[model samples]
Structures are given as structure tokens and as C-alpha cells.
Target: MKKLYILFLFACTFGFAQNPGDIVITEIMNDPVSVSDTFGEYFEIYNQTASPIDIVGWTLKDDGTDTYVIVSGGESGTGTTIVPAGGYLVLGRSDDTMVNGGASVDYSYGDSGHTLGNGADEIVLLNTSMVEIARVNYDGGVTFPDTPGASISLDPSSLNENDNDNGANWCLSTTPYGDGDLGTPGAANNACAPTCQTTLGASDTVCDSSNPGATDDTYSVTLDFSGAATGETFVVSTTPSGFTIGGDDPTSTASGTITVSGVTEGTDITITVSNTGDGGLCDLTRDITSPVCIPINSVDLELIGIIDFTVLSGGSDGKAIHLRATADIADLSIYGIGVANNGGGTDGQEYTFPAIAVSNGDHILLARSLTAMEAFLTTPGYNLFDVYLEDSSEPSQNGDDAIELFKNGEVVETFGDIDCRPSSDGTTVTCPNYQFYEDAWAYKDNGTWTYGAAQCTDHDTGNVPSTWTTFDTPCVYPFVAALSTQEFSEGELSIFPNPVSNGNLTIKSKFDGEMKVKIYDIMGRQVLTAEMKTESLDVSSLRPGLYLLNVSLNNLSSTRKLIIE
Candidate 1:
């Protein structure tokens, strides 16, 4: 009889051993977005069998560090722990009631010695006899990636315990359960689907015009789609008026290059691609600013002159530099070189050109003040092609300082040397360079350095003025007429309402062959430029300030002062 009793006990124990797939680890909130791990961390177990399972002696553990024993009732253990079939049991930190998106906390594991890791860890569920029921070794961003504020849920369609272990069968929860957060903690899992994505390829910068000295430009971009249906058609388009598509409207391929032409330099351009056939998933857009065309060589630009000092007091007009381009160039950069006045080493300042195009023979003035520079010009009412403000040491110097021009970080031209000792003390002391009077100026004449007399007067190219000039009044250089005989007729090219209040300022030219017009602000920054085939040129986009307008026809050009209110 005793032998029979022992056999019956062994059978009962074996029958009570829970199956491995009876209870599955269905969802986990290992990484909660912005919430404290102690309060928001949790793991969910779903009873997958057809009957209720008594989990009184079941244990939930993480990576052998934490173990939570299933108890009957509250924290102290009052009743049996029973999980109904198809029901969920959430075990989480008990410090906060709102954790895990406010789901009903089935068991408190707050005092557990271990915490869920955001990167990777293992979660295991065992029966009373310490037999493993289910285990998941999840890698934070790898096998089981983190879904901050959302729980990682197992697909309901694949409810087997073996499926739960494989991270591929799991996904981030999409159901909004609590506090506007995503995760179906105590509910059914959300349906999952394969996603298709589309992306834009790199953009290309190209000259706007194919002409030999063209500086204005546009760009081309390609669109690529993945996981798209066969024979899918996409429509490519661009924002703003300047851009145009080069090919047919609809393309029936996964990847295609879209030729974007006529883009305005310096303006932001956006390219969009959409599925034309079904108007479905493959739709996306990208933005890029039209880039300036850079000069290929330094020979394309020339540093022509410098207005070291002006009679005007304060502001940028007090100092300035001049440059002329022999070919159409864009994005030209200039740098100033000098010895530190603070008794330090060499000092340098730099300026870069914008996307505005500079045509051949275009003269640009970089000044301390466009207003003051214009005010000091001997040629009254003449506009500067461009004016740029210098943030570096003022071009005004005492002949000791040097100014260096750069193109693409390479030295193009240099004036003066910081190491040249031109002056000496009576005894043994010597200075690096001599100093010039405040009213004196220098210019590059016929490839030679020429110093002007104290009083302003335009002189031809030669280096003789370096020793012949004496200090007197503030020296000045007036704009020279174009050497060509195609000069515009006097008063032929004009802009109405000299001081325009509305943004719109119209340009009217009497001599009308193809005319290219450009406007510059006092700082020497080109604000607008366009090839005008018509009489009307718009100045409405210019800010309220003093500006110079240069209108060129063939080899001839004229300038006029303009004011925008």
C-alpha cells in the first residue's frame, strides 16, 4: 500500500509541472521614454492556454539578478495568484501608480534587487519547482530594440512561447492605452505590417547658363524608392517659380534622376516626389539652397585699389577696398592680412561672396560704410556694383599694414609686408613699415602700386605717385568710365522715385540691347542681379537702405544711387 501511494504522488507532481508554452512573456517596457526606470519599468505575461493557471508559486526573474515570487493577494501575500486564460499579468515597479502607461499593476516588484536594463537583458518565468516556462534574451537596440515610452509587444498572431523568444516576432506597441502613450499592456496586440520607405539622393550643382563665363546656377536631384510595388509611377516637382523639370511628368521606375533646371541662385529650393498612380506611400520631399558658382582660378579676380581713409567719420564708409573681376565668378572670398596693433602676432579678417553672379569687368567695392563710401565718391549719383562690409581691421592703414586677397583659401594677391622695416629710430630702433597720412590712398595702376596725393584726384596707372604725392586733403578716386565706346547715353538709364517707399523700384534704360543690372547695398553686398531682356527691373525685395545700381550693356556700364524706404 505505501509503494502504491508513492507512485500516485509522483504522477501528481509530474502532472502539476507547467508546460513551457502555458504562459508566455508577451510584452516588456524595459525602456520608458523620459520616465524613471524605477517607476516605469515593467514586463507582461499572457496566459496562452485554454484554462486558468494557478501561479501561486511562479517566479519572475531578470538576468539572475532579480527574482519576484508570485503571491496570493497584496504585497504580504493573501490569496492564490490566478491568471485567467487569454488574460495578462503585469509585473512592474510599485513606486508609482501611473507607470507603464497607467496599466493595472498585477504584482509589485519594486523591492526586487534587479532592474530592467535599457540596453539588453534576460527575462525568465519559472514554475514553483524552478522549471523554466519561458525566457527572452533581449538586446536593447539589437534583437529587442528599445521603444521609449512604448512597450515591446509580441505579435498576437504568433502566440506560441517559442515565437515570443524571437525578437523578430515582436514589435513596438501602437495602441494608445494610458496617458497618451503607446502600448497595449493589458489588451490585445496591434496588427503589424511591412513598411515601405522612400528617400532623396544627393543634389548636384550646375551652372545655370552654359555660356563661357556663366556664374548663375541650378541643381539636379534624384529620388529613390524602396519596397515599392512593381511598375510604380512617381511625379517629381519643385517649389517656387525658378525651377523646371527636364523630363516627362511621370516616371515608372524605383529610382530616377530628376533634372531640376532654372533654379535661382541663393534661393531655397524644395523637390518633392509622389506616387502618381495610386497616390500611396511613396511620397517625400527635400530642400536645398542653390549654391554659388566658385571661380576656378585666382586670375579671374583682381584686387584693384584701397581707400585707406575717408573724410567721413565713423562707420564702414571710413575705409574700403576695391576689386574687379575679369570673368563671371561666384562665391569669391577675400582675406585681410596685418600685424596685430595689440602687440601680438599677425591678424587676419575674411569675407565671402554670396550667390549673386559677378559678370566680367564688374567692379565691386568693399567698404566700411556704403553710405559714406558713396558720399565720398568723386562721381556723384553713380552706383557701385557691390558693397561688402569688412569686419576685419579697417582697410585704413598707415602704409605699414598689408592686405591680402584670397580665392578658395589660396593667396591671389598681397599688398605690403608686416616684416618690412621701412622706418627707423634715430639711434638703433627700427619699425617694420612706414606710416601714411590719414587722407592718403593707394591703388594698383597698370600692375603697379600708386599712392594718391593728400587731396582726392583720379590718376592713371603708374607707381610714380608713391614718392610724388604729399599729404593735403582727403584723397578720393572717382568711378572711371568704361573704356569701350558703347557707354550708355547720359540720363538714358535711370530708376524712378530715387527714394522708394514701397519695396518696388523700377529700372528704365534708354539704350536697350541686352542689359545686365545689379544692385549693391552700402556694405558692398550685392542685393540683386538679373539679365534684363525687358525694361522693368524689380527692386522691391531690397531692404530700406542706401544702394548703388550698376547697369551694363556690352562693354559699357553706368551707375546710380538708389534708396529703398
Candidate 2:
């Protein structure tokens, strides 16, 4: 009774069919782990015709040395050998439910005569005439899935002789049969949509770095792709070596982006992706040039000058700051400016720069009013301004105020000590280190600030250094940018032996007749004063520390930070 598959031969009466769609191999469980190969190994076939497909005497064989004859079954008592339209047929090595992993075996191919190969084998079905009706040559999971305990099933929606030929048309079955093994034997198969790499290429511009505020110029190459199989892992590599390509290996999804870090700029890259396990069918390759990295410069500038007056009527404008770039600033938006009114401390950053790039030594005039600045620059001696931007904000300083330069919301540089207020009792000359100015402008020379001659409305004597020969009554501000930055640093004035290790320090300048020298300590107290008859001055009398050295020749003066050891 257990070996009763011959019942299929007694009750079945359908003869041979000739339609190509009559029968198609739908699934295979050659590598089943639930049971031994002698009992659990099996393959499934689906009937495509509207009528039953009976393999009464059809020969089931392989290309090499495996063959089985469909005869009077040995273990099926149900006599279900005839596959009804849209039904399945499961043929295996054993017929007993206990030994065959619970699969309802329709007919038993003798375990001695025929068995499916676990790797690289062909399945051939022949009709009564010995003519090949259908065949599937699976190459050992190299192309098709090879997961253990799971049978490879054809896509049921397109179940046909031609569609079953390609390995891509099959998927590992997940639906478990009665044996608790994964397969859809003796029934319709689950769907299978094979995913393979379709395309790959760079999609966006190369950025300076993956991080913000970083100017280290980290190079990267990012590529986007589609069609990598879900369960399969794809490998990405670059030809020119030295890169951490494909972060996380893109196993997260079927399609997305993969980035290559640690890449060097200006290297020619050949990006290759082995989508398929063997790279046999679906692979991606692209050729691209790693561009030169563009760095985003942080706030790096020197506060070169500032102005606080305008001759134009209704003098609510003409307030500005003069800046010189220390590097190639890629973005200015991170830099801001603020004015500390009166003796008050910082008022926070009030004016942010727009998106602009400034090169080293380029002078900038961020002003309160463009119209007022242009009208004022028309004065006879105005030049020096390179780049101009107008905005009514923090830099709108009155005559008596301090200016702070901000980078990333923090102050990096400050001009005119914010907490220091000028003291004038009408009799004594104004405070020596006073930052106040009235109806005038101030310019930076040798990294220190000095004022242009103008009336000090608050104080009678004013007692401030002067350089401008022309000043309009209410607001006559003149600027003389006679030398470029290079000439100013290298040609115009050069001071050497500044530490005054011995007694004498050398000063190189265009003049040699006579020069006035005034040295002040950090507290703004005039410490040493002298008149240099030649290029050498004796400073041994002063103690060792930081000091401000103001040198004036024929009214043109320059103040520099001096250090004594």
C-alpha cells in the first residue's frame, strides 16, 4: 500500500500531447536539506494546457548519466499522475510521505537509475516519440539561486518553455511545502523577479569635503546605481588604488548611492561593480576624472581700516570697514561684523556677509550706503577700495565706537577697544589711547590704526595723529592707497632687529633726513619718544615686552607692533 504509485497508471487514461505549452518544468529541489537525496530530491512541472497533461510514458532524463521512466507509479495510491490544466506534478526519489519529507510524490524515479545533480545539470523531458519536449540547464547556482533547503522555482506568471530557459527567470522558492522545507512543489509557484545591475555612473558634482567648515579638501567620488538583487551583495572597486569605496557595501537596499571616500583629487578613476556573483552577465564600469578639490575658506581676514564720516548731506551713511583677505575665502556668509557703540561691550554680530569669494590682499569696503560711499569716493584723493558691498547693519558705527569682526558667530578680531572710553576734561589733551573720532576717518597702516586730521567736536585739543591733507568741513574724508599690499610689506617700509636685543634697531624707509619715533606700552602710555636722525634708533632704555612703535616721516606715519626681548 505504501508503494502504490502504480495506481496512477491504472486510473489515468490521457495520452501524449503535442502543444509546446502542454508541460513546463516549474521548480526543482535537488539540494533539499530536509531529507536525504535518495528520498527528498525532487523537481516540479506545471501543466500549461486547459486540459490535463499526462506523462504516461514520457522519459525524464538528464544530459549526462541520469535517466528515469515515468511508468506505473510505485507509491501514489491517489492515481494523480495526470497533471490537470494549471496544476503541478512532483516527481521524486521516494514515494512514502514519511521518507519523502511530506511531499505528495506522484511517481518515484528509481533512486538507482536517476537523481538530480546538486551542481551544473540539465533536465530533459521526452514525449512518447523520444522527441525533446522541454529542457532546463541550471548551472549549479552560479546563475540561479543556490540557497540550501530552498528549491529554485520558475516565475509562475510567465510559466512557459522559453521563459524557463534563462536562470534569471527563476528564484529561490520561499513557500514551504508540507515537509517544512522551502518549495512550492505540487502547487503554483510564488513569484520571482530577478534583480540585476542595470546602470552606474556619477550623478552629482564633486564637493570639497563631506564636512562643513572643513577646508582640508577631502576628495570623494559618489555614484548611483539601480538593479542590484536584494539578497545578493555587490562589490565596488576603483582602478586607481587608495580609496574606501562603497560605504557599507550598499547591502541596505536594492538600489541607492555608494560613495568612495579617501580618494585623491586629479586621479583618473575606473569604477567597476561586480553585480552578479561571478560578474558573468550584469556588471558596471565607468571612467571619470577626479576633479581638483575646491576648498571653502573659513573666516580668515585682517581688519585693515574703518571710516565714520561722510560729507554727503543727512550724514546717516558712509560708515564702513576696510578688510583684507588672508586666504582665498570661498564663502563670506560665515563672516559677520558688529559695532560696539560708545563704551559698551560687544553688541553681537549684526551684519553677515553674502556668498562671495575674496582672494588674498583683496581689499573690501562693506559700507552702510552704496550711494553715499560712491559720492564720497569721488573726493580727489580716494582710491584703494577693491570690492564694495553695501548693507545697513552692525558696521554703521558713529565716530566714537568699536568694530568687531565675527566668524561663525564668534568674534575673531576687534578694532578700537570696546570697553575703553575717551576722557577729556576740557583742559588736558584728550586721552592718549582714545578710540574716539569726530567728523573724520581712520586707516590701518602696519597693522595698527591712526586717525586723519579732523575737528574733535567733543574735545577742544583732540590730540590725535593726522595724515589726510584734505578734509571737507562737515565730513571731508580722504583715502590714499598709493601702494599695493606687496609694495607696502616689501618696498615701502622695513623694520629689522625689532626685538632690540642689543641697543639699536634698524628702520628701512624711503626717507632718511629726519623721523619722529613714538613707542607706547600695551596700556597705551607713551613709554619712549625720540627723533631718528638716521635709520637706527636706540631702545635699550625701555623694558622687554610688547609695544606699539609709531614712526612718522614728513607727516606720513606707520604704526607697527614691536616686541622687545
Candidate 3:
């Protein structure tokens, strides 16, 4: 009788330990593409219970011999690692804060014995007495596929522990975090389940009716009925309206294609399909957000010019130059001058125009290496011109080096100061232009190069963006023009109350003939363009900073510094 009573007590105690769904493994980033696994590997856990749980003495172990004990209340073996209700906890390496793709680590397993498997592994959670609570046996590209530099997140809608073991319940994380890594660590899992899958097809263009030279936009989309029942129907709609759909709605029988028309130029739009089937089992719906645009081609082509340059070492990425086409051009060649860094330097590197065409108002990125540039920007969507320049001919430009763009063997645009400073070896002999450091970009404003903010890229043409302004920050070198040119001083131009505090700046100039007034930020980005019928200009919308005001009349132009407080 005493033996039976002891057995009942043991059963009761085991039942009170932990429930099956109290905690769950939400995300796993076993492999990182940018950095090594030692510094970037991590896993996240979510607490589903309504009250805080003291998880002291809890053991997290992999299929291998590695195990990490949760330390709480400053105790090694017995203490409480209190996890708030409905919160997340990240278990990672000790120095994960330094390299773990910017994930917020709640606890570190240390670096000694904890390493997750990249191919196949098992993660098990246990209570104080070593009783198993949850276990996930995942295999790369199978149970939980591996996506380098991205985490494999479990579907939140299907958060059951039993369903989590299935490979279908897992997906590659699309949530961007940390220095461009993808995952939501120490937070709720991203929604992964899809009622239907939609894909955008190639775009087609026709001549615009409203505009004389613009093109009419048309797009194709394919919708697959994967999670819905047969004979179900869906209604297609688009954001910004005026999108006409052609063809039948999606059904479980096969994938359906729809032609969308009446899209506006230079604007982005989204397409949504909602289930309209009567008495359907599921209200399945899906959306293809932000379709790629088919840019209009143009007859005249002009180099909007280079906006920024990255020259310093140990920067997030390597050197890059931004270019823009005012209008579309076919088979255009862009060659660089003065890129060679030899004892007797010559223009050696040339990027021949590819057979493919560039669209009107499109931005082009030229870099030393496409792979290095993508890794630095953390964006892989940039279309790079594939021309590998020799090391001696690459744009290894300093502040004083000149980079000129050539078209048809003619200099269309030029950047940098040719004779301001000379190169040096940094130690015994230093030059003004050779002072290269990390995170500094040369900004062109009002036909002059100057020091501004550190930015990855600027896609806008003909103007410097506000993102390129970083005033009074250290680690920046100002621009020094060459001897032959005197810009912004050709005309007698002045502004009263130099620092305009009331959002109104008055411009005083000698010439008068319907002067075109343009305002640019310190980075040379034109923010406001208008005709100055009067001397006073309203700058209420502009933020507090330094700006350049360009006043152009008949045959004369002048630039003046404008400060807004």
C-alpha cells in the first residue's frame, strides 16, 4: 500500500512539471552567409504561457554532447531565469552580441561547448529534473531547410509542437534585421502561412495616350491555388485603382494568369486577390505586393552625374559610384578616365556598354565587385553592370583624384579635384587628399565636391537626398577645388538674415528675367525648384540644416549658402 502511494505522488509531480505547448522553438539560424557560424549562429525560444516562468536549472542541449544550463539569480545550478509571459528568449554564443546578425540575446551558452549543426541537428528543451519538454529534430533542406544568412522560422499560425516537426511548417525568414540578416529574434515569429501563392510575370509596355512620349504600363501575374479547395473563385484588385484584370480567377484545377493594365508611370502598385467562392472551406486570399516596373525608354540621354563615392578602408563595403540617366538610351558606353593608380597613371579601365538597354530615369551602380557591394549594402536587388576593371584601372580614387565619365569619347561629366592634394604613404609623408578613413562619402553640391554624411547609395537623380547630410561629425574631409575654376562666386548673390528661422529666405541678385530658384541641401540634392517671382522664398517644409540656393537668370547663375534653424 505504501509503494502504491509513492507511485501516485511521483506521477502527480511529473504531471506538474511542464506542459507540451508552454514553450516553443521559434527560429533557428545555424548558418550565416556573411560571417562564420562561430559568431553568427543562434536560436530563439518563445514563452506561450500567460504568466512568467522561472526557468532556472533548465537545460538546452543539441543532439551532440553540448548542453547549456540556464543561469538565473546569480546561481550556477539552482536559480530562476525568469522569462516574462508571452516574451521571447535568444540562446546564442557569448560574443553573439558582436556578430550574431544584430539579434538581441537574452542568454548566452558561452563559446566553449555550444555549437549548432548546419546540416542536421536536434534541439531539445528540458526541465530542472531532466524531463523533456520540447524537441525539434531538424534536417537541412528537409525538416527545416537551411538558408545561409537567414533563419528558418516556424509558422506562427501552426505553432503546435507536433506540427512544428513537419518541414512544411517551416519557411525561410524574410524579416530583415541586424546588419542585413533575416530573422526576428527575441520577438514574435513572422507570419509564414499562405492561402495562395502569387507570382508576377514579365511586364509589357505600350505608347502612352495622355503623354506624348511616355509609355503605357502593363503587367502579367500568375496565381496558384495551393491551399484552397477546388471550384473556388477569387476576385482580383489593385492598389491606386485603375488596374483592369483579364482571364479567369484562380482555381484548384491549375494556375491562372491575369493581365493587368492601366498602371501609372513612375509609381508603384500592389495586386491583391481575395477568395470570392461561395460556401468555400477556407477564405483563402493572397497578394503580390509592389510589382516590378517597366521603365519608359527615352530618346535623349544625359549623365545626371555621380552623386557619392566611398573611398575609405574597413568601410561596410568597398568603393562605389552612383550614376543616373536623365532619359533612356540604347547601347551606351561609359568609360572612366584617370582611374589608374600607377607611377604614370592613365585612363586604363573601361566599362563597355552591354547589348541590354537602360531605362529612362534609371540608376546604375558601378563597383569594383558586385558580390562585395551587395554584401556591404545588404541588398541583392541592385542591378550591377558586369565589367571587372583591373586593379590598376579601378576607381581607387582619393579625395583629390579625378573621375570623368566619357561618352562617345567625349567627357560628359567630371568629379573630384585634380590638383588639390597628392597621394602619400601615410607615415613619414602625408598628403591632404590621402587621408582615407572609414564611413566617409564625397558629396557633390552646386557643382562642387564637399564632405557630407555616410550613405550606402542614392537612387534619386539631379539632387542630393537629405540622407547625405551629416554636419559637425568627425571622420570627414572637406572638398578643395582645383585652381582653374571659381564656382558659386560668379554673380553678386546674397541672402538676408542668413539663418532663416521663420521658414522664409529672401534672395538678392543683380540680374532679373524670371530667375529660376533652386534649393539644394548640403549634399547637393535639389529639394525645392521654383520660379522666384518675388525675392522671398518659403522654406517651411525643409528641416533645420545648411542649404545652397541657386538663382539662374538669362545668361547668369549664382549660388549662395542658406542656413535654416
Candidate 4:
């Protein structure tokens, strides 16, 4: 009887105390966009009970070799790690926001002991005695949000240890955190209740009575929703254009058509359907886009080429994009393009195509300057591109910048790694992070990307996008002989020691009087600006990479690509 009583006491001591579900892993940002994986990985845990849990000696591990003991809390290197009663705490690869993808890390697992896999990974927490507490294994596949730049978050309704294990209880965080990746770390996860899914249906362009004829068209499309219940209200909104939300706006979850009047010919509109909210607790948002109006094409539009032509001034004035239409688009305004500008990602649609129409075989060119664009065309000038628009503010790209193509305020495609810049080797090849195109260009053939020496391939009746030829000498496209002989009436300007390794860079020009000099980095950020009378400028303070030297003399100004090694 005494032995039985002792056994009962032992069960009471271990069973009711420190159990597995005491803490739960709620969020995981395995793939971070603002910073590298080495310093950006992080996860959040919540203490489920009404008692504070001191996790100072707890161990964090994955299914594999990653394992680390918490020697600290609210500190990075080492300290006490604690989870407040019913509160959340964040542990990450680094505690520095500048390096950890803008997350406020509560405790940092040293770089040596932890890493997150972008594909499939696990987060397991254990007690000091090595007893398993809680765990979550997420396969970065269909059931989870595999988008690299965002975090996978647990639904607020499923914040418990039991529900979080279900992949269906998580989603890609839509809330933008610091530096632009999406996730809520060190804070409560976003609510994912009254969840709704959206699908865009067929779209058509028709004459709008508001304009009296077909001169102005209204593009109408249908939005089909699922998983939304009755009494749930959905609000609708559009960007770059206004649209009339038809059936189900502020009503039940019935599908309906939305009509956008006075539609621009060459751009797309983003239609947002959102729940009115259960006073903000059960809100849902889904952004749907207008169809590409491609009757027979399966995928959306494609980016065919990236050009950095060496114009008359040997400047990147010829920065542009080439595209071919897959279907006869009645309105081209449904598409837009933006340069990621250095490594910073997704500066959404800086240039929107104006209202226009094009045939299935038409070739379109979006250029930063039409004057510079004419210099790269057929012999006389302006003969290749079926449609062209010059937007001085857009396609303001350098050799290493990434490009994003937007449809309805969303990035439907990208040309390069929007988050990676050219490394010290003059190429992203070290990381294969982003495609490098300096004294070269890239073209797409049969949906595959191919890089070649900067060459001219004007439209041909036979090859369509036209095959390019490569030449390794003279740093200029051989076809430049047929380029327009447009001279700079403002006189000539040049730079000596063009690829300046160190010391001063000398600016040579006919208008060599007092000049306003500005040097901008590859990202278009002005780093240095000054007014000087002499030609020599000190550049020793600048880092080694690509820069643009903009020199203004009297009323004339010129920009040239300056390389620093």
C-alpha cells in the first residue's frame, strides 16, 4: 500500500507539470528576401498556458543535425530565454535587423548551430531534460506558401500546438514587414479566418456607353470565389483604374463580374476583394487580376529581351525591354514594367503602357528614352519595334538591375533575382543569384533565356524575335554601323580611365567649364554630388562596383556607366 502511494505521487509530479503542449511553434520564415538565409531564418513560439515558462536551458532542433541550447533570452548571443504566460517570443539566426531580414529577434541561435531550408524543414522544441515539447514540420510545397520572399504563418485561429501541425492551418503572410518581405514576427500572426479563394475568369473589351463609341472601352471580367460563407461581406477595389463591382459586392459569397470603364489600352488593373471583417478578427483579402485577354495563350505575357545598348554617348541611354504579344490584345494597358533597381525587389510597375492595341505577332519596346532607342534601330531609324513608348522614369535600369513585369498591380513575372545584386566578381554567377548583363544582353527563344554578347537582331520576317550574332571585339555591336548617326548637338563629353580602379577619375568634355557632377550607384541612388571647375574628381571613398557619372556643363548633361574595381 505504501509503494502504491509512492507511485501515485510520482505520476502527479511528472504528469501535471512541464507537458508537451505547453509551448507551440506558431510561425516560420524559412525563406527571407530582405537578407540572406544564413542570417535571416527565424521562428516564433507561444506559451499556451497561463504560466510564464523559463526556457533558458531548452533545446531547439530540427529533424536533422541542427540543434542549439538556449543560453539566453531577449538577447542574441547568450542569456535566459523565456516565454511569458500566453505570450509569444521570437528566436532567429541573428538578432540584428540589418542582417536578419528586418525581424526583431528575441533570442538568436548562433549561426553555427541553426539553418533553415527553403524547401522542407522542421522546428522542434525540447525541455532541458531533452523531453520533446512541441514541433512543426512544414514542406515548402503546394499546401504551404513557397514564395521565397515571405514567411509562412499559422492562422490566428490555429495558434495551438495541435492545429499548427496541419499544413492547411498556415499561409503566406501578406502583411509587409521591414524592408518588404511579408510576415509578422515577434507579434501575433495575422487572422486567416472566413478564408476565401479567388479565381479570375475570362475577360473581354467592349464599347462603353460612357464614351459614346468604341474609342474608349470597358474591360469586364468575372471573379469566382469559394470557401466564403453566407453573411460574409467582401469589399472590392482597383488600382490605376476604377471598376464597377457587380454582384456580391458587400453581399454574400456569390461570384460576379466587374467592369472597368475608360480602360487604358496597355495596362492592367488589380481588383481587390476583402472581407468587411468580424471587427478585424476574421478578415480576408484576395487580389485578383484581369485576364491577359490572350484568347489562345495559356500563360500570361513574357519578357523577351533585356537591352543595354551603347548609344552615341556610350551611355546606358538605350536601357530597354523587348516583348512579343502572344495574342491580339485589344488593350495593352493591362501590362506594366518596373526595374527592381539594383537588388531592391519589386518596385511595382514604374511604367504603364498607354491605351493601345497590338496583334499576336507584334513586337513592343519600352525604352527610357526614345531618342536613344532610335539609335539602335534599322538603318534609317524607327523601323523594328511595332509599338514603342518612352517613359523617362521607367526602365531606368543598369546592367545588374532586375526587372519585374506587372499585371493588375501584381508581379506576374520577373527577369532576374530581384533580391540579388552583382557580387564583387562583376557577376551574380558566384551565387547564380541574378543574371548579369553588362556589355552583353539576354534574349528569350522558345521560352528559354539565352545570353550573348551585345548585338543587334532587328525583327526578321523569318525568325520572328530574330536570332542574334555574337562578336567579341571592339566592345560595340557590329550592327551599330546601321544605327542612326544622331550627334549630340550640345557637344562631346567623355571620361578617361573609364574603369577606374582607384585614384581620381578625369572627366573630359568640350563643355569643360564649371560643371555640376553627380555620381549615382547602380541602384540609382545619388552617392556623391558636387560643383567643380577642374576635370579631376576624387573617387577613392566609393566602393568597388558600377556607378553612373552624371556631369552637367552649362545646360547640357550626360550620364555614363562608370566601373570601379
The candidate that achieves the highest TM-score relative to the unseen native structure: 1
**CA lDDT of every candidate:** 0.61, 0.69, 0.57, 0.67
Cα lDDT tens digits, model 4, 1-565, are: 9999999865543332169888889888898878888888888998888666878777788999998777854345453376777888888888888877688788887575878789988889888788889998888875666788888888888878889887778888888887888889978888765443443455555433333222343445455554444455556666754656565553454455554555553346666655655432234333434333332223235788787765543455667788877657677888888888778766777888787887765567777777766644432334445677777666777767888887666777788888877653554344264456664566775666765443332224354432222221233332222222232254487677978977689877775478778886643357899887687898888998767676777666665668888
lDDT of 3 by residue, 1-565 (tens): 9999999865543333377667778889888766677767778777767666666678888878988777663221222255567777677763345576677766666565668888888888898878787778889885466878889898887666777888768888888887778888877778775533333343344423344344554444443333332465655676667767766555442454555555565545556655645533344334444333422222234332232333222232355565555545666554333442322333643544444466554455655555554433322123222222223224455433455566655555544333333333335434443232224455444444544333333224455343332121232222211111222353466667878899887877775567678886644467999898898888999999767666676655655567889
lDDT of 4: 0.67
Q: What tens digits encode model 1's per-residue C-alpha lDDT throughout 1-565?
A: 9999999865553345378878888888887664567777777778877666777767877776677786666352432256667777777775245554565567666655657878788888789989998788888867564777778888888778878777767888887655655777667777655333455566666755433345555445443333333345666677875557764333454454556766655677777777745655566777766665544343667777666543434433456777777766654543332333322234554555544666665677776566555544533322445545544445544433456665555666666544443332313324333333234466776677666554343223343233221121334353333211244677776767778886666667665588888887654557799998776667778777767777788767766677788
- TM-scores, all models, native as reference: 0.46, 0.40, 0.33, 0.34
Q: Which is superior by TM-score, 3 or 4?
A: 4
Name the TM-score of candidate 4.
Answer: 0.34
Candidate 2 lDDT over residue span 1-565, tens digit each: 6457666654444535665656899899888788887888888888876667778778888988877777765445344468777788888887677987887777777465788889888888888788888788998877777777889999877699998987878899888876688987787788885465355645553754633334455566678876555554667787986777764454445567877777655566787877567443556787767665533334467777677653343356757787877667788788888888775888899888899897754668888776666655543233445578887564777766778888878788878767755532312334344445655667766666777544421122354323222232333342433211122234667788876788778987875557778887644457899888778888889888767777777646666668888
Q: State model 2's lDDT.
A: 0.69
Q: Which candidate, 3 or 4, has the higher lDDT?
A: 4
Clashes per model (N, Cα, C within 3 A): 21, 9, 4, 17
lDDT of 4 at 33: 77
Candidate 4 ranges beyond 4 A from true positions: 1-17, 73-75, 78-80, 196-565
The model with the greater TM-score, 2 or 4, is 2
